[model samples]
Target chain A: MELKDYNSCVQEWADPLFRFAYKCSGNEEDARDVVQNSFEVLWQKRQEVYADKAKAFLFQVAYRQSVDLFRKKGRIQYTEQPEFSGSSNPGNPDLKRVLERALSQLDEQSRALVLLKDYEGYHYDEIAQITNLSETQVKVYLHRARKTLKNYLVSVENIL
Target chain B: MVTLENYEEYIISYVDGALNAAELQELEAFIAHHPELRSEMSAYENTRLMPDTSMIYANKEALLKQAPKRTISLGNWRSYGVAAGIIALIGTAILLWQHTNNNHVATIVNVTINKNTAQAPVGPIAHENPIKKDKAIQQPVIAAVNHRKQARPGIASAPGINRLTVNDHQNNTAQPSQEKPEVNKPVEIARITALPEPKTIDTISPAKVLTAVITPNETMVADKQDEKDPFAWLPIDDTKKQGLKDLKKTVDKTVKEVRSVTNNLKETALVFKFGKKEITLNF
Candidate 1:
């Protein structure tokens, strides 16, 4: 990809990648950094990247950068905003809070697989490509992530 | 019968729709056999937490606005490199021109002034010193190095110093500085022949122009006198410039009686008669 086309790719995929990154890391600032840095990596290796596979390649870079950021910041706890407090359903804040906390409980790889699957609707193979895992690993890890979420939410329900 | 060991796999595959029809019926029968496992199935089924697309897309539009739109190309760089190369080549060409202009030595004349045409041929004067009788005898050799324009037929230019302008013998008395010609190249030696006595003005043959050979040792003695002032044309440091000025002042005070042989000399001509022919030459 040329630099011109890479900028276009940024315009094209920046949001979706940001959306995924924001979901993976619950911080908007970190998400933006991850997206910006991913685009930067794509720019550096633009010669090797094809325009067709640019979206997948960008998401992968964002994933690794997000994971690195997660490690660098230690075990990141999601800080929920006041705007995320009010919801259409009366009980949604609790469920969403429980879900966010539960998602943070998973390891970085498992959280990445789950976010790639649920937020992006990627297939096991696509999630595997993004996370550098085999399809079986993606499936198994995503299933484990779902189990953790369910257990956390269930315990929250039991307390309520 | 779904056992506890693989129950999680059966439940996950069932939720993922990876179970075949018989395995699905069996898992359904097993879940129906267990009631507490039903809510666990519901929790897993509804565990997907999606990012709000509207809020993220709004953020995306703002981020995209901040990103730069265009990039530099390889073609642009090639043009830049080519432009720099042309500028460098032009710079080198200018420096070479300046060096060539400043580095060359000024041309000096090696004429021997003859006071009397009877003792010397009136054809050309080669050196300024009257004391050097040997140089007066080898006047033809100095004529060759300086190649002064001879008034009559016998004088000719030297062979090697071809790219020089020879001063006429009449004007040789004007500038002593011009007489000490400064050639940039190292001073070299050459064999020269003396002019022969003319048998007849009409029979002054070209073969007889170079008649007698002179020794190189005689010219070396004259060249030692010439090396003093040849450095006048070059740029010098302050110390050397001061030294040259001091030397000039000292020479002006001490060398009053030693007049330049080329200076204050009147133009003298020698007339030769060969039977019916007459040759009047200036010295």
Candidate 2:
């Protein structure tokens, strides 16, 4: 895409990407960094990037940079096993906190895949492309991440 | 019968809409049998929907404020490098200029002394003395070196010095200072004796030997031969005596004159040519 087109695309995607990044990163500052850095990458590679796929590219870039920030700070681990437990009403405030904590507990790629799929309503193929995984892999990862959040919510309710 | 693992795989595919019609029906029938698995599915769906509650828009203004907006795309570090390069270039130019200036001054002084000394005619008194010649050579060398020092800048860098192949010449010329003891003693004497003595009024001018005296000094000392007061008015040379007689007869001019003498012979000549003009002496 040319600079003009990329700029208009940025205007369209900036808020949504920022909203997702802010949710993922848990802070306005880091969220903005992720979003701005993603736009910068898109701007730099504007010529090579297809205009139709610009939205996916921007979100992927932001998610990846946010993941890198999490890894570098050692706030997230890469190899924890997900736990699944059956529960009722996982969206309550206490269960929500438990689920958010469990969501944070998942690996960055799995967390991003789950968020993109379940929250953003992205297709499995779209998630796979954005996360550089196969469509099957995206489904598997999102399933595991969702199951872990569910188990943590149920277990936390049992404790309460 | 569909197993629990098969059911879970089928359910996962169902969530992704990847399962075909029969597989979706099987997943639905399996979940119907398993109430706990059905509740897990509902929990997963709720978990998936929940992150949006906390989702917030990133504050772009705060991010931009913290990250320092760039006015110029070139970095500060690179600008510093450019500034350093310019300073280095200026320093090199200054060094080169100083070096060339010094060499030019040295060359000029060397050539000037060489030409000037060669041009002057030696007087009879100095021509007879071998010591005078030795002294003359020594004195010129000191003057040449002093002039070279004043004219030659020591700090300047010279590229042409190598290409011109003047290394041996420079070494040889610089070598004389190493033998300065021998050169120094004679140089002092040559400088002192070769210099013309101060003149007295009693002595006539040496104008007859040369063109008009461009740097005439009445105080300049004439050649010192007179010691007694006999015929003190007599001109220093016979050529001057004839010239004065012819001048007095032709112009019939009587000129007031003052002459001081310690001997009969006047120690100075009456006429001399210096350059393009003839100058005659009256006293």
Candidate 3:
């Protein structure tokens, strides 16, 4: 990719990549670091990447740095804890906060898969490409993660 | 296909928008048959996270890149033209300087020749002592030439040496005839006859005289050859012609040096100034 195309990728994909990294790593600082590193890798390999595939390439880098690296470093740490606590309290009825808590509950890989699927709306194959997983694995993991989230939301709804 | 065993997969795919029209209809029909599962599917749909538009990456300007620097090459026609013009100008200047220096040297040579010719006595002078005749003839002419040369600093003294030698020879012959009246008449007559005719020296042009002074032996041979060949009207000395060729070679070498300097300049960075901004392009 040319410099202009790479810069355009930065402008277009930086926010989404940051959000994906943030959701996957559950830390704003780590998310920012992931975004910076992903763009840096993209710039270094700009010649090898095409402008059309730049977004996917960036997401792939972000996914590996945020999910794989964080997992390798041990269990995930949330610098900013989600507002919702897993409790039977009906006062906290915010569905978005409950969903955030639910998303934090999933493993890093599954969370990255879910973020890649829902936030970026990538297909199973594209998510597999980004996460370096088979299409079957992406589908199975995403379904499992969706069930976990649905169960959490159901329990919260029952309490409400 | 949307049975209870595989119902969760269909519900996830439905929420993910992965279900096509037929799969959607099948899942909806299955859900209609199981009204309790409708809320379950709705819970799965709520799991799809909407990206917070407010959670944008701040300072996007930091990720942007500037365009890479471009290299300038010497292939430009303007650069070639400038180099050619510089070489030509340098060559012209060298040639002009050489021409002017040659003319100046020739002028000095002619002035010395004219002065020597005018000062030397036409008639022979007799010397009292034969031993002193040789020294007297040599000393005065050399001293006079040296004194005249010293008067005009930086002029070449080589061209005047030959003219002074001829003048000393004339003086030596005159010494014997004037100082020794008792010497044999035949010997005195032969000595006078041996001397070159003054008319011959007066008749020869200054340019030929200068050529004769530079290469006396070669000039004499060429003169003898000219006596035989009818077409030998222009008698050119080989050494003088070689000197001119050497000067031409020097001018050519100077032009080559100028060309090399210009080529080196092409390898350096070209800087252009526009008001306060300066752009430098490297080759």
User: How well does chain A score by TM in each candidate?
Assistant: 0.85, 0.78, 0.89
**Ranked by TM-score, top first:** 3, 1, 2
Off by over 4 Å in 2: A2-4, A76-95, B16-22, B50-283
Off by over 4 Å in 3: A79-92, B68-115, B119-283
Compared with the true structure, what per-residue lDDT tens digits does model 3 show for residues B139-199? 1111111222122343233332223232344445545545433233211111111112333
Show pairs that collide, candidate 1.
Answer: B108-B181, B108-B182, B109-B181, B111-B126, B111-B127, B112-B126, B112-B127, B113-B127, B144-B158
Query: Scored by Cα lDDT, where does model 2 land?
Result: 0.50
Which model, 2 or 3, shows the larger lDDT?
3
Q: Name every residue pair that clashes in candidate 3.
A: B125-B174, B126-B178, B126-B179, B127-B175, B127-B179
TM-score of candidate 3 relative to the true fold: 0.55
RMSD for each of the candidates? 19.8, 23.0, 15.6
lDDT of 1 by residue, B169-250 (tens): 3334423245334222222221122333322111112222231112233333334443344445668432233234323332
Model 2: lDDT of residue B208: 21
Cα lDDT tens digits, model 2, A1-160, are: 8755776676666777876776566556787788888888887787899998889998889888877777776664323325434546444445444566777777777778767766667898898888888987877787787667777777766676
- DockQ top scorer: 3
Worst 10 residues of 3 chain B by lDDT: B186-195
